[model samples]
Target: MDTTLVIRAKDVHMEFPVKNGPSVVALERINLEVPKGQLTALIGPDGAGKTTFMRLLCGLLDKTSGELDVLGLDVEAHSQEVQNLLSYMPQKFGLYEDLSVAENMNLYADLHGIPMGERPERFQKLLEMTGLSEFTSRLAGKLSGGMKQKLGLACTLVRSPDLLILDEPTVGVDPLSRRELWAILKHLVHDEHLSVFVSTAYMDEAAMCEKVYIMNHGRFLGQGTPAELSAIASGRCFEVKPLPGVAMRVLQSFLLADSRITDAVPSNGAVRFITTEPNLEIAWLVKQGMTPVPVEERLEDSFMILLKDDEQELAASSLVIFADSETETAVEIEESQVPKSDTDMPQLDYLHLTGQTIADDAPIDIEVENLVKQFGDFTAVANTSFQVRQGEVFGLLGPNGAGKTTTFRMLCGLLPSTSGVLNVAGVNLRHARTQARANIGYVAQKFSLYDTLTVYENLRFFGGAYGLYGDALERRIYEIMDEFGLTDKKDEDTSQLPGGYKQRLSMAAGLIHCPKILFLDEPTSGIDPLARRNFWQQITRLSAQGTTIIITTHFMDEAEYCDRFMIQDKGRLLILGSPADIREQVQLPKADMNEIFIEIVERARDKGAM
Candidate 1:
């Protein structure tokens, strides 16, 4: 073992056995070295064996074959010693909801056998660093999504382990909290000389690390500095904008469907795309009356191109794509057609609507007037108002305790407002709550389905609760199962399914009733890039068929899919506009959604808006 290397793996392979068949290979030929006192990032698409590798390093799972070394010790042979020198934080961080923030930290400190004499100094520093000094006595359950994440990090840092393994620590956190978390990690590396290994799905976070290892199918595809990997697409990236009077959505659709284009995504009133044909010239876009400009490549540009190339290579080799199970197949969907349902329903007619047809004149589907919600002396939301039009995808954004979810619950009829005019689909919720709720579907942030029940059983129960019975319920269940590609796994227990499959099942249950409006809360929080793409494709199809969608998410990039977005802070509405409009309104020329969000929120705070 090299003295400078904190962790090393040589020809490592991991496999799980089946009942009566071949073993499943999760990781193979994994060779890597992490330098001491530096930050290393491990990233991959969903189900790419990221968590498995983390588990192996933490000694929670025994490796089937190969050698693993942590701090110059064999992990398998000295598992107990290895575990004592490191900390691991899983996706769903374990926090005692009933205990106060201070109590939770004290418990972890005791578990690590920290001296009581040094506790005060360490606790003070951590509390100040994580901005939780003011909430020490607050119960963990009362903290917001971002606060709980910060507390979890504090607990893991109690002993100052030699190595820290964090698995998606910022999955459901807001942009501001994420920025703070990264700041803390950077400080630790520079001041304390801590060696950190973290896995994340966000490309921006991965770019900030000193070294990044891209993992797929249990193998490392690329390993280098951020700049080294970004050079992969140095000359192939271009920014294209629509001609005068042409809509950005129209141009985005054309580019995404073009065979020459590898990946096209909407960003700031333009489409950023990479080409399969390296020799394509700028004159081609000019001839088509579109403005094209050369732009600097970012980490995401390289990641998308690399993943697409890998998929094509796998197809040519006749190897199974990702997984051999039917559940992993990418379902191709048509944008022009509505979902074929047995019941009579109207579609949104997206293929036929032009820019003028989708303007503010469209019929209003949701209305909020002077909405206010209070608990004791605390005001969660105050005097907020917004409207969403029919067949539109609307996004609600805010900081962790900025009242985004509270507003969402009121719109879904799960919580009532103190005093306001809350209406959905022309029905006032205060007077006709049942009638208004009957037309909306909801997917909660956390998993809310039955764990022991099979996929089919869960779906059938939800369908029946929505008023379907007998053959109708059965037919609807089968239709949704087929639509989401869940038919073959209907007999599998919901808790045992993969993370991606569980997400699909949750979505299937929400759409069983075919409500006029859909409410989604952080629907794609921790899934891989491919799963997120598939999820948005389904949302686009539903919008084309006239389903109004109101969603709240922490992933800033997903805001590109919203027709309009509203940002709130301290229960006050701050900004509401299109992605392009928000940037232009804030006077930031070429910033992405994440930067724009930070700037707006900071500006508001400096001016006492929060």
Candidate 2:
């Protein structure tokens, strides 16, 4: 290995034993080298062995074979020496809920043995760099999703190490916080010459790194600069707007079903697809009055092609991915039923079996008027007013600890408001809490499920708790299992399932009683792109069937799908409108929702509203 390299790997292999099954190979003969003081990225989906490699480099796990080196020390031979030279931040939250932010930082600094004379200066620098100076006295548990991630990073860097390894540090953070976090990393790399190796699911984040290693199934498919990797998709990437009457999702699903199309997604009222079929002739799409338009390649486009190629090879070799058990059982609607013409685009009855309707004159499902919540003289939500019509998808946006979750709890009947009116399904949540609770469902961000219980048992328990019994409960459980693509994993323990499957089961349990309204708090956080897409597809279908949805997410791109969205900061409603309306209010042309969000939040802060 070159002396200039900060990290090096040679033919590394890692395997884990599975009960009564073949050993799982997390890494296979991997070879890589990272030059000193460079920011590198490992990009892949879930179950791609990214965490395995990180653990190996941190000396937390010994490799089954091959050599691993970090900061010129063999990880296995001199584990302590290597560990002392690097800082590793895992995916989970690493802060103490009971301690204040400043307390947490002081604790980490002391653990690193920083001298008392220098501790104050070091902690101040970290807090300022991470933009957490003002919230030093706030408890860790009250911080927003993104702020927590920033605090985690600050804690990891208590003392400058030779290397910094982060495992998906920005998993569920909002766009504004994400940009700020990356700016911190870029600043450290240039000013202090810090070496960083981070794993991420966001393609945009990977593009910022000097070099990116594309990993899949525990092996490096390719490694190169962002521009060089993007060249692989030249002339092969294109976008096609949906026909006059077609929905973006309808077109996306249609394209994805074709064998030639490797990947497809709905983006900004159009469909972006990657395919080897150069001619781009789809008889079905053509008959439906659509044309594909050529577009420039992106890092994400090339990365998807590589993953799809690897997946095809695995299928050809008869190798199964145990983590994706539900892939084969996913159901797709037929083309004829997917709106071939304007007249054919009828309202999809997703809950026809249960007989739900979304009338044009449907009454408001949720009504919050001048809502206020206070905790010991600290006002969490102040004078908030909103209304959600039946079958509408409403998005709630705000910075961490901005009262978004607080308002969500009040609307769901979990918390009593200190003042003002709150109603759900025509029942005042503060008055008739029982009736309001029965008409709605809730899915927490962390996925609250019985880890030790089988999938069916959890569903049965939830259904029974909802007052269902006998064959009715049995039928509802069966329906949810089949609808959520969980029939194959009926007996699988909740904890053993993958992130996507676990999310599906969580949603199934919530919907077991056919609630008219659903409250989702950061429901799609930390899941891969494919899983997020599937989850939204289910939400779209349900919304069409008269299920009013109230969702809060850090992902700004998802806001475009909602009928209306509201942004709050410091317990005050800052903006409320449709996606386009919000963009127009921000006065930014050609800006995505993320950029719009950043502009709005910054403007609010500038006006002393934050």
| Model 2: per-residue Cα lDDT over 1-610, one tens digit each | 4668888999999999999999989999999999999899999767788999999999999999998889998999999998888999999857998999989988888888878888778888999999899999999998887889999999999888889999999987878789999999999899999999999878888999999999988999889999999988887776776654344544555555455676777554357888775545555555545667777888888888887777742221122111122353232453444433334442333213222223347689999999999999899999999889998888999877788999999999999999999989999877799988999899988898999999999999999988899999999998889777788999999988877788888888889999999999999887666566667767766775678999999878788667679999878899998665686778774576777887888898898944
Report the C-alpha displacement of residue 50, candidate 2, in angstroms.
1.2
**Candidate 2 TM-score, true structure as reference:** 0.89
Tens digits of per-residue lDDT, candidate 1, 233-342, equal 78778889765434454444445444466666677667788876554554445655666677788777788777777664222222222221224333232433222221
Models 1 onward score TM values of 0.92, 0.89
Task: Give the distance in Å from residue 533's predicted Cα in candidate 1 to where it truly belongs.
Answer: 2.1
Highest TM-score scorer? 1
Give me the runs in candidate 1 sitting further than 4 Å from their true place. 243-250, 279-288, 312-357
Give the worst 10-residue stretch by lDDT in candidate 1: 338-347
Residue 148 C-alpha lDDT in model 2: 93
Estimate every model's Cα lDDT from 0 to 1.
0.82, 0.81
Clashing pairs in 1: 347-545, 348-545, 348-546
- Candidate 2's clash total is 1
